[model samples]
Target: MKAWQITTPESGLRLAELPDPELRGGGATLDVLAVQIPAYTADLVAGGRGGFPLPIVLGAAGIGRVTATADDVFGVRQGDIAVATGLFRSGRAAEPEEALLGWTGIGGDGRPTPTTDRMRDVWRDGLCAERALQPERTLLALPGAETYKATEQLAFLPWLGIAGAGIERAEVRAGQTVAIVGATGQLGSAAVLVALARGAAAVVAIGRNRDALDALAGLDPRVIPVALTGDRGVDGPAILAAAGPVDAVIDTLGAAPTPEPTMSAYQAIRTDGRWVLVGGVRQDLPIPYGDFMHRRLTLRGSWMCSDSTILDLWSMVRTGVLDLSLLDIQIVGLDDPAAALTAASHRHGLEIVVLMP
Candidate 1:
């Protein structure tokens, strides 16, 4: 097996011939089909994300074909097509620690501890190579995924599941309006589609990229793109005018320099509307206490999706409720991790890079 190995944060990714992963208790070995290379993978590999276990395979959530499962592993059987969610939870009753195998997502708190490190040490091999060993707990079997011709596009399903979960947390329903912050990004784009599939009357897609925003608006008549101009007054009024008063606002902004854009969207929501934070924004949100108390608003934080959500997303894809064809996927090979990482960066909504091993 040829797998991309990272010995140290600064060492970068190197392709090395390694032994194929063997099934272990509570785990399953998979013949990896496709892995979506995230836009920040280059920065992650360059030590910009965070530290992780060394001498490990570096990849995250993707699709795979089950080759074998350990005796303790049930539900996911051999010859089944499943999505390796890359998310592993401790299932601990208190402060349950979690980690993204082969990637840098630490615990639910995004802070590392001994428990998270141990979790990564055991399941360090991700779905980046031709073969991978994954925890059965993280594998969700996709019944009819075997017939899905667009494997590369299907690799993006995990993200859709995540975004769909955000929408679900916001309690979005048919005939309601949604405001997706950072709508030009990959997850935001998925939220737009999910919002539509969930029967949202309109999706006010808000982002900084005009071209990408325009592209989203072009997808469906229900999509209304709003390009941010950094001014909260201007952007907030624009968002409010777009839909009058949005029923839910899904904040998917990543590492924003300022929280104004998010706040702008937040203010545009209706009095009793919901706000769900599903992004990596690293700022302290300043919520007006009096206004928040009076408005009876609901604010929630959602990170990853549950198995049920992933199954629901698969059903959406299978039933044509959500069109995976809308995504413009760029396929890359396994040998060149450097090139793939480079290509993965700088791509916006519907424009993605997938590694087909």
Candidate 2:
């Protein structure tokens, strides 16, 4: 099978022909269809994100057709379409460990531990290949995806599902306004659509990019674009003016330069509203103890989604509620990493780059 690999950070990312994986006790082999490469994939390969096992196949989450599953893998069988999410958990009840199967994500602290190291050793090869081997826990079966024509668009499922998980954590609902910070990015853009699909009366798409905001507003009349100027005082008021008393705020800002963009949107949350953090904002959020206690506000930190979240989002795509046709996707082959990596770096909302392996 041909797959992208990085023996070391100094070696960089490359395509290589590798031996087929042996079927293990809990592993499943897949014929990869389309795999969505996120904007920061280049960074991940350059060792900017974090450490992973050396001599590893480099790819994150994607959709694939199950060619075979271990006998113990009963949730899905052969000839099924499986959603291979990169996220994998240790299944421990107390402070369990987690690792992004073929990528840089380690535990919640973003630090690599002995446990996470062992986890990665077991499942280091990623989905950026003609075929892949994944643990059953990281695979979710999609019943009708076999006949789904738009495989490139369907590659965006991982992002959409993650965004939907954060939205669900915020308890977004009909007749309520929701605010999505960094709404111009891939995950944030997905959250905007999920909020709309869940029947939010209005969605405040807050971001620094004006053109992307305009694109989001064009998706629906209820989408109110708020361009951030960085000043929390001014931006907060602008967000509120656009969408009154936001019932929930999902912040998906990645590696933020400052927390102001997020805090500004935070100010618009309703008195009893919820705030969900799913992005890579590194700054410490200074929440006033008095105000938080007085307002009865809630805060949740959501990572990759649950099985139910992806299933629900898949249903929406199948039913045409969350339209895939609106997306602008660029599909590429497995041969070139330099061009594809550069293409993936331009963080345009709803503009995707996929690998058709």
Give each model a TM-score: 0.98, 0.97
- All models: lDDT? 0.90, 0.89
lDDT for 299 (candidate 1)? 97
- Residue 57 Cα positional deviation in candidate 1, in Å, after optimal superposition: 0.6
C-alpha-based local distance difference test score of model 2: 0.89
Q: What is candidate 1's lDDT per residue for 8-65, written digit by digit as tens? A: 7668998888899988899998999888888888878888778788988978799999
The stretch of ten residues in a row with the least summed lDDT in candidate 1 is 100-109
Expressed as tens digits, the lDDT of each residue in 1-357 for candidate 2 is 888889877999898899987778898999999998888888878887887888988776998889988989997799999899988899997888888988888667878888888889978898888999999999999979888889888898999999999999999888889999999999999999899998999999999888889999999999999998989889999998996889999999989877788789777888999999999888999888998888899999998888899999999999999998888899999999878889989858888899998
Give the 10-residue window scoring lowest on summed lDDT in candidate 2: 104-113
Clash pairs, candidate 2, are none
Residue 189 alpha-carbon offset, candidate 2, angstroms: 0.5
